[model samples]
Target: MSDFLVSRRFYAFAVAVLLLGAAWTIQSRVPLSDAAGGQLTSPREGFPAPEFTLEDFQGAPLASSSLRGQVVVINVWTSWCGPCRAEMPALERVYIAEKSRGLVVLGVNSTIQDNETDARGLARELGITFPLLLDRDGAVTSRYRVRALPTTFIVDRRGIIRSVMIGGPLAEAALRSKINALLAEP
Candidate 1:
């Protein structure tokens, strides 16, 4: 074989390997959003999170601005999302673990499907004591562009999104780290 041809083939192979590795790394990190409306299904890592006024489980209007000067964990989730189900226990643990740090973990329920009772019941069964709001018109979900289940946004005391967790099968350590970072900020 000609030396030039061998070198060219070697370079092509190296490029292919690099591209494959990058793709795998990215795919490993991303999860699809199961959104009701056609919107952004993933939580962006560094964007001003979409804000909304949703009612608490008690039906009290909970405004986003109300969380100013407090660390709020905004979780966009659906009862039917498997990853959502898997991550709840860890989230509850984090909420209990950090509530005293001015943390308010609010789970925004998605209504892409026809049923509400089942989702509500599942949340209840999970012993999710935090504020869970219903996005019946899906207006709130559309605003956030949540296309997947269990997308979590961590808002700092300044009401800015410090970080986002997507496709959560998160460990307690992971949740704690993000919460701790937000807590550390002024």
Candidate 2:
């Protein structure tokens, strides 16, 4: 009787593991959306990137929808993050080289966790030319589910998220390769 009980327990555990795995697989295949539009927006790859409109560092409104049909690199950062500071120049170089090829690099500063003055100062120090979109109220940051300071989302021309790099001083060479491949895609 004890042996049978032990075998039954083992079987139950195995079934639970299998069920969890199946659930994960299904969730990965189906992107979830939080909005009422059911647009499949998610921070995961193969999902539509979340739409946002924020004031640029210059106080002009910039909408993600306005960048349709262009490859976008959205880098969520804060001025105090060391990795964010380290990757700014690489991001700038990539933006400059690829903007003509339809690349738009948006440095999304989580201003609630940072300040505009420091963000501007860093941009000047690093010669960053990409638009710095400020998330003053933290809405954009929360929408992106940014758990780290330097998360980056690579969205293709169709606005589908192609890659998500979390916690990075992402290498310029790697960044270039990813962008080139996405830009090459139809």
Candidate 3:
């Protein structure tokens, strides 16, 4: 009967261990909330923006590394997103105003679930003359961790990510402010 007692105790211990392990696994999977935790800053901030080589609307190759010396504003967007559509004019204005000041606005069309024609139409309608990159399979979007439509990242001239704006219809004034700040950086 002592052996039986020992076996029962061991089984109980093993079960307890398994339950604790499972609890830990589940807790680790939960996303960290900004309020409950510390301020949740963009993962890319202070890090080099993930390099990617994607084709523009006209099939021209555009690589992130090639724009190293210029402050780059990368906007990940889809034509179907209302906020994305709304921010196009502001983005274009910022592009026009700051392009000569060493700023390049790259509109990355998240085309995995969008039609190429629709993306082109939106750009044309908005008179967006900035370089529009085509993210065909969402690889670039995923790399940037773009969780929402119209997310924008401001990259400094040294290729470090300076700021990230998510859920935009970003205003022209706000864009200019951010761009001016980045342009001022060496």
Candidate 4:
């Protein structure tokens, strides 16, 4: 009887593991909005980037629509994310090098789990000059479908997303290349 009970327990555990694995596989294949009941759809290359209006850290309103006609690099990040911190310098370099060439790098802060003080501190520490917009409720982050910290989207002059990088402490060279490509586009 005890042997039968043990076998039953093992079978149940195995089934549970199999079910979890299946669910994970399915979730991986589907976009987050479809897999999870999220309202925001993930933006992709060649798609019109979702529009969003959020306040900069200074409380001034900034809108994506306002950035049309420029190559925009929108980076979704939080102060506490290690990779985000690591990538700030590279992002700053690209921003400074290309800003005059019509490149606009907007750092979108994930304010749902971050504070303005910390965001400001990080920006100061990194010496980031580009505008840092606060996504107070993570609305913009969700719209961008930024699953990981340091996700970046390169939007062309026409407002179409040209590249998406999720999870990074991206290299300056790579970022510069993407920015240059977008700048080269009409």
Candidate 5:
């Protein structure tokens, strides 16, 4: 009877392990491209980006309309996202490097579970100097139909969204190329 019980328990444990493994594999193997609304391919091109006014990390209103007529790189991200934080310093570098050249890097902080105070602290710690727009209710996120973190929208000089780049902290070459494209726009 003892041997039978032990064998039954062992079999159950093995089955559980396999099931968990299968679940993880399914999740990890599913590409981000397969997400709802599919991959965002610059469809926003030649279309004006949705304007929003939200509290910044400093508690000031950061309005999208305020950025009218400037080339802007709008990055939708959150503090909790590992890839978001990892890629920010690079974005900051680009911001400082390009601001004098008339490029604005606006970070839209989306779906923060924590309160504003804690979120502000995290932003400061990240050394992000650009405007951080709060999206506590994810209204702006939804307007943009953002499905993933580290998503980027490039706005042209006329305030039109020229391109959209999604998933991960983009490679330096890829980022520079996109930025250059924005810079070239009239």
Candidate 6:
């Protein structure tokens, strides 16, 4: 009887541990909301964009907070990234076509993994005219949680992140469609 009781108690403890682990896993995966049931500010879609200021190649300081009323496209990339090179023209085209409509495409170089010379050269070569912000210390990259070379975050005019593109030689048509949809929004 003692042996059976001990075995039953051990099994119960094991089950409880497993259940707790499962519960924690599920909880951690779910997005957290504020006390008022509003979406918490984060770097993800439907959340307020994590703000940062960086110097453009011309050394002009541009802050994300300053772009509140404009639809902003934050592209995190390294100069050596092939997809970055490929998408540069498309991004530039979108910027030129939509700038008057309050579209701002910010090319944020992960300068921690790259250099100023190479980034500038690539920009010149690709004829990219949008502001190329340098993340010299990787602070902006860390804030945005950019794990990939060419991550793009599309923030709506109200400063909330509306979409996130992880990796791509993102097609011009698709990019334009997403931006146009957001631009159409109030």
Q: Return the TM-score for candidate 4, rounded to 2 decimals.
A: 0.76
Query: Per-residue CA lDDT of candidate 5, range 10-91, in tens?
Result: 7898899999999999978856675433333332766678888888766788888888767888898877778888788888
- Give the distance in Å from residue 17's predicted Cα in candidate 1 to where it truly belongs: 34
Q: What lDDT score is found at residue 117 in candidate 6?
A: 98
Better by lDDT, candidate 4 or 1: 4
Q: Candidate 6: misplaced stretches above 4 Å? A: 1-39
**TM-score-better candidate, 1 vs 2:** 2
Error at 125, model 3, angstroms? 1.0
TM-score, every prediction? 0.72, 0.79, 0.76, 0.76, 0.71, 0.79
Q: CA lDDT, every prediction? A: 0.77, 0.92, 0.88, 0.88, 0.79, 0.90
Superposed Cα deviation of residue 87, candidate 5 (Å): 0.8
Q: Please, what are the lDDT tens digits per residue for candidate 4 over residues 1-186?
A: 668658978789889999999999987797766653443434988777899999997899998999999999999999999999999888888888888889999999999979989999999988889999999898997888788888999999988888999898999988887888778877
- Using lDDT as the measure, the top candidate is 2
Task: Please give, for residues 109-134, the per-residue lDDT of candidate 3 as tens digits.
Answer: 99996889999999898888999999
Which pairs clash in the backbone of model 4?
Answer: none
What lDDT tens digits, residue by residue, belong to model 6 across residues 1-186? 668658978789879999999999988774554433454578898888988899999999999899999999999988999998888889998999999999999999999999999999998888888899999999999989998879999999988898999999989998998899889887
Deviation of model 1 at 99, angstroms: 0.9
Extract clashing residue pairs from model 3. Answer: none
Candidate 1 clashing pairs?
33-147, 33-148, 34-147, 34-148, 40-145, 41-147
What is the lDDT, from 0 to 100, of the residue 49 in candidate 2? Answer: 95
User: Which pairs of residues collide in candidate 6?
Assistant: none
Cα lDDT of candidate 3 equals 0.88
Worst 10 residues of 6 by lDDT: 30-39
In model 1, where is the ten-residue run with the lowest total lDDT? 34-43
lDDT of 1 by residue, 5-63 (tens): 57978789879999999999987864456322243333455444566888766678988
